[model samples]
Target: MKKFLFLLVMSFSLMLILAGCSGSSEDSQAGGDEANSEGSTEIEFWTMQLKPTFTDYIEGVIADFEEENPNITVKWVDVPWGDMEKKILSAVSSETAPDVANLNPQFASQLAELDALVNMDEAVPAEEKEQFFEGIWKSNSFDGKTFGVPWYLSSQVSMYNNNILEEAGLTGEDVPTKYADVLDFSKKIKEETGQYAFFPSIDGSHLLETMVTMGVELTNEDMTKATFNTAEGKESFQFFVDMYENELIPREVLTEGHGKAVDMYQAGQLAVLSSGPQFLNTVNENAPDIYEATEIAPIITGKTGLMNVAAMNLVVPKQSDKQDAAVKFSLFITNAENQVEFDKIVPILPSIETALEDPYFNELPESPSPEEEARIISAEQLKNSEVLIPPMKNYSDLQKAMTDALQAAMLGEMSIDEALADAEQKWNKALQ
Candidate 1:
């Protein structure tokens, strides 16, 4: 009987051991599933003022990217344009910046200066970098490092009112193609129709870009000192001073910004509107009659014959753990296929060379709208355009100096020479 009891106990002990092993295997399988879940990465992307307007489009893009990259997910956040700078700076300070951000070169440069952005030169492959326009691609680069990838570009196009032209006894051929002719054209319009030709706002960097287009160099070699206080610079400043004094441009130009120009154009007070083609939609919605009478032309240029190209770029923060994934998304969004689609939605030109070659940009409908014609004109001029004022350190302060000096000259507070000299002094101080 004692021998039988001992064998029975041994058998029960063996059964318990087998059960324990089975449980251990099941636990291991569950842990493996958890690891797989943890392996998938989710990245945050931030865009400026593209939420409600581009929600469906951006969401679809995210969906497509995720479908292809099954292990990665994208979380998109849209910030208001005015709020982006503060928000991005705050995020960077907290080390909680988004994995990717849509920013302009000027703003991105600030982060790049702080070493908070990824070195795109090393991250982007040569073949991929070659896909964008050389000028547009370099717009985001400074100090031998590229911080962002070019996405969308806007080259200014002159939108004139056909009714105003006819009222002024001017034909389409009479529109000015260069700055020298614009003054004469403005005089004709003011005399014939009693309407201002256009408003060249001295606000922000508009005047600075105008001077650059007029062949006034802003800085010397190595950018260590001011160089725009020369003969050409004085001439450029005097041109606007003459306009303001002669009542050719409205007095409101002294106090208002580009928005006032648009308002006046839509209201039929101004004859010409120099702005992006995308703005035609606003005119169409707000003032259908003005929209109907709108005519498109290539932007007026100065001696250099170069147009100003404004670009929006995509950037990855250095703090992002998923740098590769963020860059992949950036390239995917700005690729030829995607950029072409975006161009269709908005009249802005694509930065990608192949995207610009797409038939959509080159070809127009049989009866194209003013916006469509403007798109074509803008695209045709893109090859000759560049970011006139490339990103620079203390660029805003530099612009403000020029603006204040220009305002002083325009208001008769100082002579053109004094204004330029003052601007040079301020710029030199800022450079230091």
Candidate 2:
């Protein structure tokens, strides 16, 4: 399954590279046609899986942008989240790629590596760039060049079950704010209440980011080699190994993903859940009793005090004829004023500094729900949060290598030293 998933991702990346090559001539022709045409210019825009729910809000933004710039017409397309990679590659291959598209840093980095994206550092003025949070804005940067503009961000917050805490003879104040105390807390909850404290899955990039939060340097300055085979890396790897071997965490975490964690949390099988505020709504809908018992706290971090931030970004394709107009639209949508409005519709935090300063994020009602409290706490952590696992070439491969090694160690298939050495070797090969 791992090999198949890796190959599937590689195939998609290959398609993107080939698409950039085949569409060059057509892109030049399109640019020529746009230049020769009248003053009117229509640019295509694409967003991911935001239809029906956010239709009115997005359409209103488009209407506002077009009204402000009469010469530039905007065409908005909403693509399903699961189909975005394949569909975007197909559009690029056919020279039908949108002028501006919403993408995460990982996907945008692949395009940036191929020189298929415009350098936002050169296109967007420095003064305009200062309006966004530095850490969030830097998420889209690659090799000293900015490839995308920062958009809405989601930072993890610790949500605990008040019922479970009381059952375990603990209180809300006993909730851990550092990873160093999580193991002990988990042990206490398991021993007293016969329930797991949390599920720390190694299935995806979660482990990688956790290691970084624990102060494990993933790579050298230029990212040319692996640098995580040190004492800190071994300690971080052993943290999970000890948990699993001692049965402090669920056994299914070895194979299952984060969804399983959410399920466990909803069923009251888990005491603490570290996830975004958006998930609180799902818990409320599916498990109202548990939702009522849910209490919000700051995300648990390591000694570095850094939190994890998942962000969406906007990028302008290099092949687009309307590069300038695309950048303008990207900026306009992600600007302070626009981002604050979007926050009204959803619980996500804005990337813009001034937008984050909005009372919507800072101010809470006298009787705010758990979701509202979670949002406020999440927003407060944005200054310290970042894309912990920054975008890099072969990022997925590196993540897989580390995860496999950790799993091997936890299962007693390999010693901790052997696992780290093996993963370090694999990472160096991929980096080379």
Candidate 3:
């Protein structure tokens, strides 16, 4: 059942990706596309909301490339968030795949099975990968083959509302740095102010930020299975259950997506939220008045320490006709300038370690206070993190099973044990 739901979401997301291309005007041209190079070599491109966002930067980079080469023209396509994965899969299978497609490690495993990715390890030397955060380099690898470069990457950052924290008499000093700390704080907020302290999502591995802090890896060292259903996994899920039974967290959080968390924080109903750096833009747009009140920080510590999501991935498909050009463009897009621009909205750590260390980590946005600024960059607080889903044939399916177990636990239809047992059975079947 979990597998079915995830496939449906992917199917829907893919359709949305293709639908974006259909809606794109012949010229959504940020800048005019230069005429195809003199030799008429054309490289097709597909991206998810990269322009005016990162696409504008991409155009500048590509235009520069075109001027220098004069032999390559890029046919770029915009993919909407909806149905994006389906369109990507379809394009790769139909012999119309992009030379470079914006992909994440989530898709890396599945596509590796579908024969849709290019293994370009030779192009991206090991030394080059040293610049990225430790786990990020391994995120895009499949069966020991490097299929993608690090584009922009960010850990799951801690976000909070200064106004509410103050109301609860909590200040920077009260900030939690561990998974247990966050759970405790959430309870405090609820007790003192009737607002949520922190909401760790069951929908996905955003909860990973906490589990990682507890020294739990989502997958085992061998990567043969989803080890998250183990003793540590239950303990992690139980943290949320304790919060729920205690009324420390709002029940809406069970059904709420990340957007809701952002909205709640923006509205001042939530004292704490966890998301990527992209929350900066959402704060700026939806609740401008409260923008200043917004703060970012690293995840609170558990017994072990701070933890969060690893990063997103940049990838090449097996059918790309212009491997060399794709590599060039991939490198350019992930460079420091582009990383900064992309982070303005996406706010994840760039894969480029130099980019992150650029004294920028110390800088906060035009937020409410120094405390708010500190909270968002809290991704750097990572003492430990988990990112070990092998590019197996059935990751998306496994993720669904886990998500379902969580949801069921949240809904109280069954205990965490019962749901996980059922999920483990389903997962073993999928493995076969």
Alpha carbon lDDT of each predicted model: 0.84, 0.87, 0.64
Candidate 2 residue-wise lDDT, 174-236, digit = tens:
899998998999999999999999998777779988999899999998899999999999999
Output the better candidate (2/3) by TM-score. Answer: 2
What does the lDDT read for residue 153 in candidate 2?
A: 91
Error of 3 at 378 (Å): 4.8
Q: Mark the regions of model 1 whose C-alpha exceeds 4 Å error after superposition.
A: 1-37
**Which is the better candidate, 1 or 2, if ranked by lDDT?**
2
Q: Candidate 3 lDDT, tens digit per residue, 1-432?
A: 244654664564454433433332123223223234454567777777665566666787678778866777777788886656767666654556677777777665666544356565666656766766666667677777777776765556666778888988888667776665666777677878887776666555555445556665666455655565778778877877777878777777777767777777788788777766556777778887777776666656577554545555667654454666666667766777777665654446566667655556655566345344543455355335535343555756666776777778877888988977877777766666
Best-performing candidate as measured by lDDT: 2
Give per-residue lDDT, candidate 1, residue 327: 88
Task: After superposing candidate 2 on the true structure, give the runs of residues whose Cα lies further than 4 Å from its correct spot.
Answer: 1-38
Candidate with top TM-score is 2
lDDT of 3 at 361: 63
